[model samples]
Target: MSQHFVLIHGAWHGGWCWDGVIRELENAGHTAVAPTLPGNNPDDDLASVTFADYLDAIAAVLEQQQEPVILVGHSSAGFLLQAVAPRAAKKIAHLVFHNAFILPNGASQLDMFLPEVAQILIDAAMTVATPHGSIASPHKNVPILEDLIRNALMKDDSTEVQNALLSRLVPQPFVLFNTKVNTNDFLALNIPRTVLFCKDDRSLPPGTFLKMAQSLGTYELIECPGGHETLFIAPKIIADALTKITINPTFHAIG
Candidate 1:
């Protein structure tokens, strides 16, 4: 059966981030769409972006598709998917969390991170002032924080990929990370869910993601060998997993 896949990227990344994975999925005869959330690119206004803005982008893409989509979200996008699932429940055939954060109802991305990690993010965001006159972390342009960011997020990725990613990354709105998401509606829908935990992910830490996946009640957990950015590091593995889920609604743990 043919399936449509919508890939949502995480913080600091744009639609281009999924180019590699999109091509792989297309080669396998599946349709994939990677949309850039507003304010994440150079032409976009970083100041005006909000969590709702990101959700709307995903929802709009889902609305145009006639067939159910296997919605995949990575990194910070995990929270976006949870919010989007309830609104586009019927259009979503399955929800795949790729080394992404999975927040419970009324919980924020900060809620998923360790207290120390969360504080680091908060402190970083406090340093910059946005167009809205709010102090937030200007993550995209900060060179001094590269080591910290790389250590926390892309430690498993090749140096080339990590460098390329850092150059193109943009500042994410702090509010997006802090906003609490109501995932109860999504949980109640009983959507087929799978969490792809990249074993080498340095961003969220493997142990933290494992614990979160376990708490999701009904979810298939798959582990891959790579860092937080598997799309670039291991597109073949990620693509294969997507194909498996499309072929069988049942979630199976994979390497």
Candidate 2:
């Protein structure tokens, strides 16, 4: 059966990152849309972006959809699913976390990252601050280093691919990571969900993704082979896995 997918990209990435996966999905006769959230847009004023803008952008996309979609969140977008799901519950048929973060209520994405890593992000945000601390300061965005991307996020891909991806990535809004998210209503939803993990991803400590996946109560577990940016490096693989998880009911399950 054909399905509709709404792909949400993670920090420093815009909707463009899902181009490959969307192509594969469409070729397989499914429909998909990847919306670049508010602060992620290259032309947007980073300092003006807020966490609410992210939620509002996502909600707007759901409002336009004619039918419920298989909502897929990647990396940092995992928590986005938790924050936006309850309010847009009726618009989502399923929730898929693709090597993403899952934060508990009152916790922020910064709380999930390793201390050193989180500190690096915090430092980056500080470095961009204006001497006068202007409201439009780029300090609101946390810059990502090329080494981190090549060594951790897309380690499985070729140097050419890594460089290409790095060129397009924007600085992620700092507020998105530091802001606490409320998941109380999300936890109450009875949505069918899937944790689509990439076996070779070493972006975080081993088993971190799986541990976060388990927080969903009961969920389908779909594993593939690739790094954190597998959806970009090996789009067809991710497209197939996402298709299978949404169309097939018997995938491995966890509680």
Candidate 3:
């Protein structure tokens, strides 16, 4: 009745972001592990990090588990999932995209967004040339990212909660969005895929979540309450949804 869950945090966040959900899962007698991606740490050099570094970090954590785990990817981590799933598909029991992006092969995360939105993120990346003429990976502006969190992710959250979570936000390695990902093995692998939606999520407009899930061709649709920050803001509800997915083999199919 117990399930192992490897929760993958999206960009700009570390494993610590999943503390709330982890507690809920633990309390429910299930296991959850949120791994820290390399270079995601404040002390780490983000400029030196690559997309592969992120994949390697997740893969390392996946390898440590003796049994297959319910692989849950949040936000941009859906793209991260597509890139790493193939390499360790056998160890993954299910694919859970929690208000996450689902990109196709040979496509970058930016490809999923509107041209203006993608360009905004692209233009937002600050580039610095090195002494050796090499260019550093683009870095996101901390204030800009913080504002987005306040406006979109935490729109429904209280000011206190917003500030608390905002303090935890870190600038992302922009290269993660720039990298083009592909995974043939993951596509060929047989795994139950589920897409969980938060009705109040404003990070992307309404209908965007289902749209991304639709791109997967076929998946189970599970909906809950709260916004994009629901994982932490409404942990119990989110955890309950996760439990429902874990126990129910048959879900309402979408796409």
Candidate 3 structure quality by residue, lDDT tens digits, 57-78: 8898999999988999989898
Each candidate's number of clashing pairs is 2, 0, 0
**Per-residue alpha-carbon lDDT of model 1 for 112-170, expressed as tens digits?**
87899777677777676567775644542221357765777776566787787788887
Candidates in order have lDDT scores of 0.77, 0.88, 0.80
Which ten residues in a row are the worst by lDDT in model 2? Answer: 246-255
By TM-score, the best candidate is 2
Candidate 1 lDDT at 177 equals: 80
Candidate 2 on 1-255: residue-level lDDT in tens? 999999999999999999999999999999999999987888988878889889889989999999988999999999999999988999988999999999888999999999998898777776754577634434557776788898888776899999889989988889988999998889898788998999999999999988877779879888888889888878999999998885443443764
Q: Provide TM-scores for the models.
A: 0.87, 0.93, 0.89
Better of 2 and 3 by TM-score: 2
lDDT score of residue 146 within candidate 3? 63
How large is the C-alpha RMSD of every model relative to the true structure? Answer: 3.8, 2.8, 3.7
On lDDT, the stronger of 1 and 3 is 3
- Against the true structure, candidate 3 reaches a TM-score of 0.89
Position 142, candidate 2: lDDT: 79
What does the lDDT read for residue 177 in candidate 3? 81
